[model samples]
Target: MSDKAKIAVDAMGGDHAPQMVIEGLAAARVLYPGVRFVIFGDENVLRPMLASFPELDAASDLVHTDEVVTSDCKPSQALRRSRQSSMGLALQAVKDGEADVAVSAGNTGALMALAKFILRTMPGIERPALVAPVPTLRGESVMLDLGANVECDTRNLVEFAVMGAAYARTVLGLSRPTVALLNVGVEELKGKETLREAADILKQASHIPMEFVGFTEGDAIGAGAVDVVVADGFTGNIALKTAEGTARFMGELLRRAFGSSLLAKIGYLFARRGLRQLREHLDPNNHNGGVFLGLNGLVVKSHGGASAEGFKTAVITAIDMVEADLIRLISADLPDVPGHEEEAGAA
Candidate 1:
């Protein structure tokens, strides 16, 4: 890869389509002047849009492909047409060494399936986990297996810890990120046998670039109890969705509370600055990238309904991963784990 990061974009993947993708690329170009884009979408739609931003157009290469992976498409169905779809081609760019990373606001299931099939998992990794950064009281923290594998084994959870730690180190700039397994309780005796087993392994793996803090309950996640939270997909997904919903609920409550009476509305004026800051902190667009960790190459998933600003954040994330050499960091950390050697040998 060159000094300039080349991002492969699935322009047709999101709800806003080529327009959002193009606008985002333009904005990202202003922020990351060295980064280039390889966009895959309908030429008729994209070319005219790109023409609007001369700098982004200069820094981008357009690949014509009208075929798109619909939001409702199954992974199995998407895979059959992978070669022709915009999302598939973007991932293919990463797999073929044409781009440093791939970003899409497409179908999560299809993206995961196509990424795993095209890029495959790293040597000691059994599966790729969806990892994303979450806002917490301590600023920010990372979490993994958001919805990738519904049920994970001991080894799988362990792998997620390693990958999540590496991601925190790379993206969050934490040299030795603190990690925890998300469970019903913080006690060693709590949760599934797999969680306990994974905890034990992490405790013993001093070679990994993380401080294993045992277990953390779901409530502590937003408290910034740990830098990296590892959980089975089923639990992590629920935790993520719940957190998002809670943020929205809080915003709505505040809005209603302020508008309830003249006194409340008058008080809102005095608290507007602080409230604005809080809103910015909780905005999902600021944390839009959901990375597919444990893959041979980097692939980021943006929210389907993400705005141009959100899409720009996702592109920035891919560039950060490229600059941090995220793949090498994860690959280097994997081999030292207890069962990884045996697993790799078996494979």
Candidate 2:
């Protein structure tokens, strides 16, 4: 066993797997030359696919299993019946110390359920928050509860903030990350009681290792108003999808406008470089992984429809998290919370 980071992959998890999984790993191998992989899936399907990429074959070890968690599988169903499935096995590898992290492009609910069950929660975290980096004008910012908890209490929001700030410090290299709660408006009295109460607590909290910027409006997420944006899953999910849709809509409009006339085509040629930069900056594939924060081991959820390049980005993300010692950092930060001792002991 190599001492370096080893990622466990649910080889049959994605929409285009196992091909996309193998191809993505092959691409990732080029970027993370020293990293190793342990692929979990049917040997018959994965072996043939693995042969196509010699580099991946050289860097990987295959574990055969015929079971798979379908995209429509319910979390409860998966937990009760599919414990040996590809997604389940990948997380199991993490628990068994066979891999440093697990990556799956599987059912989000199923993945989250299995990971939480297998890895368990960190001492002070009530629930794991789904977090990812969002592209913004100032730069990328970390946002959490992407779809993990549809409803959150004040404590959950505070914990999410702590986790997000730690993530920002690790990935964005920020020393003291600024955190903000997403609200209807930026004022103290403009939002619901849940949001306001959370804001009040954050504002009053001390020695938490983050600057709690009062509140941020929806429009400010892409403006990069804060390093970490915290919201309940219901609101966060809508915001995430809306932002994705808007990015695609804008790209489509640009394409149509640029192709409408000869003059526009000429303009497009002149603007191609800048447009390419914009495309790269906004590409969902570049930020394809949603990490399950609060799990004992790292688990990155890749988009179900992600392409090979997208999956590679997820792999690289897992590598970065491992190098950052994200779990340890979160543990260290959790102690500063006022009610953390009671909550942690209860869990």
Compared with the true structure, model 1 gives a TM-score of 0.97
User: For every model in order, what is the number of clashing pairs?
Assistant: 0, 0
Q: How many angstroms is residue 288 displaced in model 1 relative to the true structure, after the best TM-score fit?
A: 0.9
Location of the lowest summed lDDT over 10 successive residues in candidate 1: 338-347
TM-score against native, each model:
0.97, 0.96
Candidate 1, residues 1-347, lDDT tens digits: the string is 33499999999998988788889888988988888889999999989898899999999999999899999999999888766799999999999999999999999999999999999998899889999999998899999899999989998999999999999998889899999999899888998899999999999889988999999998999999899999999999999999999999999999999999999999999999999999988999999999999999999999999999999999999889998899899888887798787765665
Candidate 1 lDDT score at position 156: 94
Residue 166 miss distance in model 2 (angstroms): 0.7
lDDT of 2 by residue, 144-163 (tens): 98998989988899889989
Best by lDDT: 1
